[model samples]
Target: MRFLYSVAWWLALPLVLGRLWWRGRKEPGYRQHMAERFGFYGVRATNMPLIWVHAVSVGETRAAEPLIDALLRAYPAHGILLTHMTATGRETGRALFGKYGARVVQSFLPYDTGWMVGRFLRHFAPRLCVLMETEVWPNVMAQCARHGVPVVLANARLSQRSLAKARRLSALMMEAARRLTCVAAQTEADAVRIRQLGAPDVQVTGSIKFDVTPPSQMIAQGAMLRARIGPRKVLLCASTREGEETLILDALGGIDLGNSMVVIVPRHPQRFDEVASMIESRGYTLQRRSALGDKVVAPAVQILLGDSMGEMFAYYEACDVAFIGGSLLPLGGQNLIEACAVGKPVLIGPHTFNFSTVSDDAIEAGAARRVNDAQAMIDGACKLLRDDSERMRMGQQALAFARQHRGATARTMALLGPLIR
Candidate 1:
């Protein structure tokens, strides 16, 4: 099965490369580092021991922030080799870790073929591999095991849907899961699922996302942005996926927003223009976030399209109520922890299986409310916007909930410390 999987990957290589090139039309970052995807990098390797971290995209990259910081602090002599799959993740890495200079190196992870991964292992010679969330690749794991690099699946999660999919490829996925030296899961449920997949060492370390301290600068920017937008209440639809935007726009059509403005930040930057077109076609006056450089948002603008990147925290802070996207259409929902961290009232849709535990816990804690559909999401958001007391109560609960979940990084470090040494 492993051999067949590798063969399938080899056969699909052309299509994969073609897709990257095709996607580069919208996100040119895919085109820029073509060589890196094939295990080629420009940076020279150093004698300093490297700790390689694989964060597949923006959310994973952001979630890895606290762990990465902890790693740097714990091992001052070691350097971090942060690898990502998306251009946005790489850009976000630069924005987050550029201050560290040469101490932190960023690169696109090689395609998960044995040869490619082998070349990557040879180049970095990292002592440990930290995979944030669910980034399991059979070839990568096999290559790392062969190269004597211990792999840790940190901040990991597995939904029932994902588990079913993995079980369908169990022969390959099970082998990969067994290659993991340890798994630090977000919840007991996550640990149980990971254990069922054959991870040898699984521990519940809560969510490291709770440990991500919103930067002071981002908070200040949010305040300034809110001021520029005047006194109108802001409803942020954050990290929305492809099809969810259409549902949200349709829902908006039925509601009279009154004094509140909607800010929709799509999950993928490539869809900014596409979503902007959708909003305009719905007859709503829209303002692109990128266009509002030091200018106030006009009151006539009913929708603010958050097209800019690396400013999610600011958007959360600027909004009175937030609806986490991707759930409206069964896309497993994007992270709501960021909004809760900012102490904003959160409204999510029904399909949050990806973050089932956290979402349920949030609702239980009064930090969030789950809606059945887009219309319900809008209704929930509008209600919160209208009721200041209710909104503030939820916001405070969100803050408290976020605070209560802190220390996952420390707990994770405790489990990983011996392995690192």
Candidate 2:
């Protein structure tokens, strides 16, 4: 299986490079780090027993925060090594783990090739490796297994589509899964799916993300922002992507809600400028969060361009309604739980495969509304805005729903305690 995995890696190298090149066209940092990963540059670390955690991007990194903190507290002697597959993930991890940078090292994960994985393993010498969510890299797993490192898939999930693909290549996936010490999945369905894909000792530990508690600073900031934004209808476009922003802006323009404000926050901080430009081109007076100069909300703006990081929770507090992005155009949607956590009425588009379970739960609980298209989003937002009573009711429902779903992190941590220790 290892030999076959190596062959698969060789065969897929060209396609991988090509995709990296394409992504580099939009994100230069991605290409830069991809090179570093393959070249094995700046891979060494201080001499200490290391625990490596691999989170693919920003969302995964955020989900891993509680687990990382717990690991640090539980094993203060062990050094932490965090690896991300995306540039944004690295940035977010650095920001989130700033004070602990000395103990927690954030870097790009090496490409999933035998040599690169071996180089990473040799440098880090991690006693335990935790792969957040479903970021399963065959070569990396194989190398960790070969080095006798205990690798656990923490907060793991396997969608039906992914499971089907893995089932077709059952031999390879099963071989990799066998090397994993344990698989802590997000749900029973996910655990079943993973077991079918060759993973051993699978356990349903729920989702660590559900345990995320918004920082107190964010709560205070949200309060101040709400006071400033006042009664004017505010629609928060959270974690919007490329084409989604245009559609959202167009919807906002068509809506007849008076004295309304729209806040657009792109998922990637790198796209702040582009999103700001898009807002300007659409003829909406844009006020950037940075330009507000300590103001939580600018009164002289129709569109508040949230171009900052680590402030989504703060913004959510100020918003009366939220349109969770990424789902508008089949990108599997961004997490809607953030808005719900703040008691904000949530809205989403038709596509939400990535967070299907959460989305379904929110909808069933009457905490979220799903729209068919841009026009429906506009109508939904306007309707939600006008009906303050309904809005408040939904917001309450959302907060309750979020609270009820909490404790997944504790469950996951309990499962990870033995392996990490």
Candidate 3:
């Protein structure tokens, strides 16, 4: 199975490169790091007892923060190598760990071909390896196993959509799963699925995202941004996907915004200009976060576009209500935990299969509400905007819900400490 999988990947090399090239048209970072995918990193090589982690993208990179912090403290003598597949993840790692200088090394993870994976493993010589979330690559696992390196899958979850895909590739993924030293799952459901998929050591360690605290500087920035927003009811349509933004714009156009401000923060930075144009074409007065610089939102502007990156927490802090995107479409929803952590009431669409457990629990816990469509979302937002008492109650519930789910990091550390020791 491993041999066949490697052969298939080798055959698909052209298509993969083509896709990267296509994506690079929008995100230049994809084109700039083409050599890294082949394991051709010319950075300073180091052998300081490395503790390497592979976080695939921005979401996983952010979720791995608590574990990264734990790894740093648990073995102060060891240097950390943070590897990422996307440029955004690498940037996020730098933003999170840039202060460490030589103590933290950020690099791109090579593609999952045998030789590329082998080169990555050989170069890093990681004492301990951690993969964040659903990255079960066969060649990578096979290479790590051959090098006698123990790999741990931390903060992992498997939705039904993902599980169905896994089932089709069960043989390869099972081999990958068996190579793991241990699996730290986010929920019991995840544990059960992983066990059934052939992971030998699966434990429900919850989600490390619950342990993440908003940065203090970001909160201060949010306060300043709120001051600029000028006492208007702020509604954040955060991490919105492609089609979702159009729906949000139409919703805003139909509604009576009055003194309320709608902030549309698209999920991908590449789409910032596209969304900004959409806002302008819709005939609403727009104020971009990037252009705002030192200026405040003028009273004439009804839509404030969040065109920056790594500032979701600030956006959440500045808003009265947050409508998490992706849920409105079938994209499985973005993470809502951050908004709730900051004491903001959240509204998600009906399509939350990606975060079904978290969304269900949040709704049950009174931190969030589920709306069916754009109209419902608009209605929900407008209702919350006017009903201060209801929003306050939901915000309090959101805070408490977040607090109640906060021990995942500690529990994960307990399970992983022995392996590292």
By TM-score, who's the top model here?
A: 1
Tens-place lDDT per residue, model 3, 285-404, is: 999999998788899999999999889899999999999999988999989999999999999999998788889999999999999998899989999999999999999999999999
lDDT winner, 1 or 3: 1
Better of 2 and 3 by lDDT: 3
In candidate 3, residue 407 scores what lDDT?
86
lDDT of 2 by residue, 1-421 (tens): 7677788877988888898788787677677766557736564656668889998898999889888888888888987889998877887898888878578977788777888889878777888999998888788888887888889899887777777788788787877888888988887878888888767799887777767788888989877777767778888889998899888878777665577888888998778889889889978778888787656465667888888877889999888899999988978888888788888999999998778888888999999999999779878888888898999999999999989888777776677778764
lDDT of each: 0.92, 0.83, 0.89
RMSD of each: 1.0, 2.7, 1.3
lDDT: which candidate is best?
1
Report the alpha-carbon TM-score of model 3 versus the true structure: 0.97
Q: Model 1 over residues 283-365: C-alpha lDDT tens digits? A: 99999999999999998999999999899999999999999998988789888899999999899999999999999999999
Instruction: Give the residue spans of candidate 2 off by over 4 A.
Output: 1-36, 39-45, 227-230, 295-300
Residue 194 accuracy (lDDT) in model 2 = 84
Model 1 residue pairs with clashes: none
Q: Model 1 Cα displacement at 222 (Å)?
A: 0.3
TM-scores of the models, in the order given: 0.98, 0.90, 0.97
